[model samples]
Target: MELKPYRDNVGALLFNGAGLVLVARRADMPDAEGAAGGWQLPQGGVDPGEDLRAAVLRELAEEIGTDRAEIIAEHPEWLTYDFPPELAGRGFRIAQRYRGQRQRWFALRFTGRDADIRLDADSHPEFDAWRWAGIEELPALAVSFKRPIYEVLAQAFGPLARALASAAKSR
Candidate 1:
């Protein structure tokens, strides 16, 4: 049985062969607006029967449109954040159901080329468009509520990114 985190989300941060991390541009978002409009890593909530790691792998495929990615590493702990009272109650009824969210972040190395991506493959698209972004710029793309989580992801994934880079040089 999976010991799921209460109201927690799981997601993966995928980096391509070129050492560039993948991010999706969430166009047409009302609440996120310009702040949420920037590039973002693939993420999703853990389903009822799914484990945290499984959830992330599933999210990566569903959000970005591919199932072939290597799990490089993951954060030792879960990262968390909360939305403000104002925005929390608005936009989509489910948003107000929780005080905050805890996320398990994964680092994945995508072996496939960019042509393999399909953001709208799922019934509901989380992002309309996608692009590769510098890992350093992630925190800035997130909203205030999600910034803390992004910071943690950036910190945890930094070493993995470096390792990925070094490994590429040897090939």
Candidate 2:
């Protein structure tokens, strides 16, 4: 067996004032899959010549309808995951050509109200529904292949989320 190439992708861990992070259900995911928790953070391919930070914000706005955010931190390194073989040929943009994603993750603090989120903002929307979920719940909510990434993020961003939530409470 040979290793396949990965797509260069940017992912967001957008945190609200309440400390919960944003996660969205894929528009293409089946109802049963959605019910089984087919949710993930806002992410997308990095457009050629786009900066990593710019890509993250663009994905947030394109996927969730708002880019009102400030970058707090970035994951120290790129993380990679494999696409499950069973998911091949299903028409997922990321799965079509790439083995999976070589992801650069960022932590962003959402600066806008919940009403700012419009799932239909993009003519080709990536997600259908979204919600603010506790950071600890991320791993459980992620697809099996992406669970480890979510686990890492939960540990990596947990402190910042708490701090932000606390700060918001005091405001």
How accurate locally, in lDDT, is each candidate?
A: 0.75, 0.88
| Residue 168 local lDDT, model 2 | 82
- Which candidate has the highest lDDT of all? 2
Q: Residue-wise lDDT of candidate 1 within 3-74, one digit each (tens)?
A: 222367877788876566888877545443345455567887888888877788788888889867888787
How many steric overlaps are in each model, in order? 0, 0
- Give the runs in model 2 whose Cα sits over 4 Å from its true position: 31-37
Runs with alpha carbons beyond 4 Å of true place in candidate 1: 1-6, 31-36
Which pairs clash in model 1? none
TM-score of every model versus the real structure: 0.84, 0.92
Residue 102 accuracy (lDDT) in model 2: 89
Say what the RMSD of model 1 is. Answer: 4.1
User: Taking the tens digit of each residue's C-alpha lDDT, what string does model 2 give over 1-171?
Assistant: 026688899999999888889999876766454443489999889988999999999988888899999998999999988897756766666576789888999999889999999999989887878999999999998988899999999999899989988988999
Local error of candidate 2 at 112, Å? 1.1
Model 1 C-alpha lDDT versus the unseen true structure: 0.75
